[model samples]
Target: MASHRKTRQHPKALKAMTLALAGAAGATAFDGTGQAAPHPTPAQVKGRVDALYQEAEVATQHYNGAREEAGAARAELARLQDEAVRRTQKLNAAKAELGTMAGRQYRSGGVDPTVRLMMSADPQRYLDGATVLERAGSHQANAVAGYARRLGSVRQVRDRARTTAERLERSEAALKRQRVTIVRKLDAAEALLDRLTDEQRRQMSPGAGPAAAPEDPARSGAQAPSSRAARAVSFAYAALGKPYVWGATGPSAFDCSGLTQAAWKSGGVSLPRTTYTQIGSGPRIDRSELAPGDLVFFYSGISHVGLYIGDGKMIHAPHPGAPVRIAPVDEMPFAAATRPA
Candidate 1:
């Protein structure tokens, strides 16, 4: 009976032994003797990091091209800022030189829109200085042209700066994230070895961690204007409330260049009518130290003009689509800044 009972239990005993063997095999089934993922080599991490760096390089190249263009525009913009300061001082000086009433009377050879509106006794009086109106119209046209160019330049600079910043931030984050993922993977792999023989742990651990890739050249190349550039900023405060003209060089009434030309004239200098011709007429002052009476040039050929008063603003003929205006340096997307003394 005892022998028969042991025979009946033989199948169960065999099944238990088979189950134990299968579990043991499963535990060692991985390429390693542990049930964990494989650890990657330094070469693999380097390969991935290098690929990321390549992408960053291409992005940086694009950034560099854009940055170069922006540099020119921003330089001009800085000049404009400088002009604004000068204009303000001039305007204040003019105000002090001629009190409110006298100033109004002086401008009322009937130029300013505000004064003209006050003296609108004859609606048809617009034809009185008929030739002057034509000049005003021309001034307006030039102002419009200059402003359009400026707007484009500003947008380009703004966009370039924004994109460059984003590129650097995103690349850094990606690199950091990559390192974090590698660390986590390594930890998991290490945990697997924790249950292994000391020999197995030694084989898996590579002491060195992932390295940072080289930075993109584009990010390295772009530099903002120097502090000297900042000082060159002069703004025309005197041009405030000045009458806008299509084209009349002012004793009163101004087109865009006319305003700039006229303002400089107050400082006792004359600038060319069109901004294009003005480019060659003056010495290109380093954008820093823009002085009162200095003519600020705009556009690639210098087709727009403003008087540098100081602090990144300017008084200029804004546009025909608008009126004679005081605008910020950033308004014109300045191509090149030159001050004609």
Candidate 2:
């Protein structure tokens, strides 16, 4: 009777064990404190998206530089090719004249003067004869020398054209690769943005929240140093809300350095097309010495730049999806500042 009673309770014990295992598996989702970690908030997502966009901007600058180089290289290649063609025409004309001279010599039974001189039995007599021959054929001799010089020049020009063509090809390849990198990074940033709710996207947009308040000029620590600087600052302000377009130095859109380059151009200053080159365009200055129209570069590689507009404020095209706007100078990591002369 005891053995039968134990057998009856076996199924109940098995059911209890199964229920305990399922409850433990459910509990594994929580932390040791017994609370489930929350999902990433909108602000966190925004920060990540902004970082990806910034990286894309860096690649965009590289792409712009490569494109400019490729353009210049193509122009150079075209010029060189034209030169080569002209040189070849000249060479062909000289060769034709030389051939005519050879035919005249053959018809007259006149051997080459150098060969005749070499086979001379009487050296003094041959020298005297050769001097008269040289005076008579001075025009033909000059043509021969000219042809030799032109042939050498044509060879050099052809070689140079070949080299220029190779350089242009390399530049074109680099531009394509940089463009690919920029697209990839921008796509990643857009994917992050897509994950956000409409309200979250709005909060993170430029000029949408309290953090996007208009910068107070009085609060800025510096002032425009010259009329040109002031004009640049004015131009930057006028460009507010313009979209950031990679490699654009334009009336419509701009990248980080493009905005600064265009703004300063309005002030009658020329800046290089890329951030790396632009950094070397002026004298380096301390952050405390910043003034309006001074370029404030950011990131360790100095890949980003903005025009300081005074009172610790700067006007910049921050990144893709963000327009030209005024923000505090410390919005990103500061690398250095420059004052264009």
Candidate 3:
């Protein structure tokens, strides 16, 4: 009686319980925990997406640097291997010469020339000939010593080439890992962006259009300090609306550092391939001293850069999904500036 009552709930209560369970099951789960979590607001999603983009860029820069190092390492390995081959050939030749000498001596009964001279009929004449024989013996000893030296040299060169080959292999592996990291981060960012409404995405990714220029005080006929600088600045302006492609140096798209490098190149100055090295390409300058065509670096790690076009504004390829456009220098946390030319 009482047990039967306990097993039977009110119809309304049972219905409510069923509805609650269904709602819980339908909500989104996070971290694979299977528990429902609150959906993130657009602002929160934007923050996370931006952080992911920054992370991806950092990885992209690392990948670029690693790729450059791998290239040089591969070239060095090739040179070392070539040297090893040449040294081995010389070693083989030396061994063959020594073998020939040994064969000749064996065929001659390997008798002591000095002993033969002592038993000669004309002992003085044979002794005079013994001097020539002694000279020949000395030459054989020198050949053996030369062979040993060549063998040692071949071993040393081969060892060095093997070590270089190993280093090159390691560098190439690191490059592959970095590339994977960059791709994963970028994909995560894109996924987050996909969750947003179209209007939300548009608001979050401002300056995404190729022809949409940012409003800047420097937009009105601003001239660079020098002719070269002027050319660089002009190149940057012409590059407006180009998409940002990590590790790209452009006629089409570019990364932050690539855009700066290409911009300076237009001005007849060559900059290093990475932000960390590009900072040392020219003299360091204060923020107040920034001029048109000067390279402005951002973030503590100096992973980002732009070309200053005066009035405290810079033209840069901001990041993924954004085009080359004008933005205030203060848009990101400023680290340092350089005058590359």
Candidate 4:
């Protein structure tokens, strides 16, 4: 399952507190306005956002480890399978050669009926020759069969090893995905948590109203793979409270793709609109070399994009009905990766 560190405070507890506070504040208001209430304090909102950022940080680490483990397991399985294949081929070839030699010996005109009759008086010699040939043939056949059987046994053991490796790979992959998902929750949780520090909350997003959000990013001055990814994530940090919109790229509102596009542009590269196009355009890369500004594809279809923030993390707009945020690279149900075009 996806890993997450739940807050000491529960959502129900927070709801109850909010209701109590709202009631108290409502009672104190003058003129029975029953009117518009004050928004939460900036400090409260900021606290929630901070919590999300911190959670993302922790989740990122877990995701990184999981991904590495899964990849290693898969590599091991591949190696074992390759060895098994070679062994099987060698065993088959040996068996086939033995079959050819045995077939030729049986099919050859070695027994002559006329010659057998002439050696009737010394039938013992004939019998001895036939027996010697039979024994020699049996020994040769047994040697070839034994070699083939031995190799087959070795192949069987290798196959078992391969199967075990595959199981391990799958488990590791699942673990990696789980950690990634929690990181997304960590991002969304910040939205609800935003109520804690209203001041910092406003800083998460900009509006005509007074400044209420925190400017200090959860991760500050992180050395990213590229200056472009860094700038993009920084811009995203400014969009903490924006509502998630479907397919909306933005100066204001944003969907996951939109947010990624805007952030990468900050670094000077222009990406395509959808995840599919972006994935097709970039250079393919193995996991070990992944860097910021490089587009990572999740679910194998390239439906997600994030600015690599280095250290196994990426700042991104995670999904529909979610906020822009930072998460581990292995997050987004990772399928594969690519460098920017």
Q: Which one is best on lDDT?
A: 2
Best by TM-score: 2
TM-score of each: 0.29, 0.79, 0.76, 0.37
TM-score winner between 1 and 4, please give it.
4
Candidate closer to the true structure by lDDT (higher is better), 1 or 3: 3
- Residues 60-120, candidate 3: write the lDDT tens digits: 7787788778888889888888888898898789768766776676688883444434336
lDDT measured at residue 43 in model 1 versus the true structure, 0 to 100: 49
Decoy 1 TM-score against native = 0.29
User: What lDDT score goes with residue 331 in model 3?
Assistant: 87
CA lDDT scores, all candidates in order? 0.47, 0.80, 0.79, 0.60
For residue 109, model 2's alpha carbon misses the true position, in angstroms, by: 1.4
Lowest lDDT block of 10, candidate 4: 111-120
Worst lDDT run of 10 residues, candidate 2, spans 208-217
Which residue runs of candidate 3 sit more than 4 Å off their true CA positions?
1-39, 111-138, 211-228
In candidate 3, position 13 carries an lDDT of 100
- The order by descending TM-score is 2, 3, 4, 1
lDDT of residue 298 for candidate 4? 68
Please provide, for model 4 over 1-341, each residue's C-alpha lDDT reduced to its tens digit, 9 standing for 90 to 100. 98798769889999999999988777767334665556656655545554564445334434434555666677777777777777777767755765565556557955333233223466445344544444455555344445435555666768777677877867677666756666576657656754545555446544314222434543554455556666766777676666555435687767556776777777687876666566665678787887655666665445556666566866566533346665677654776776765
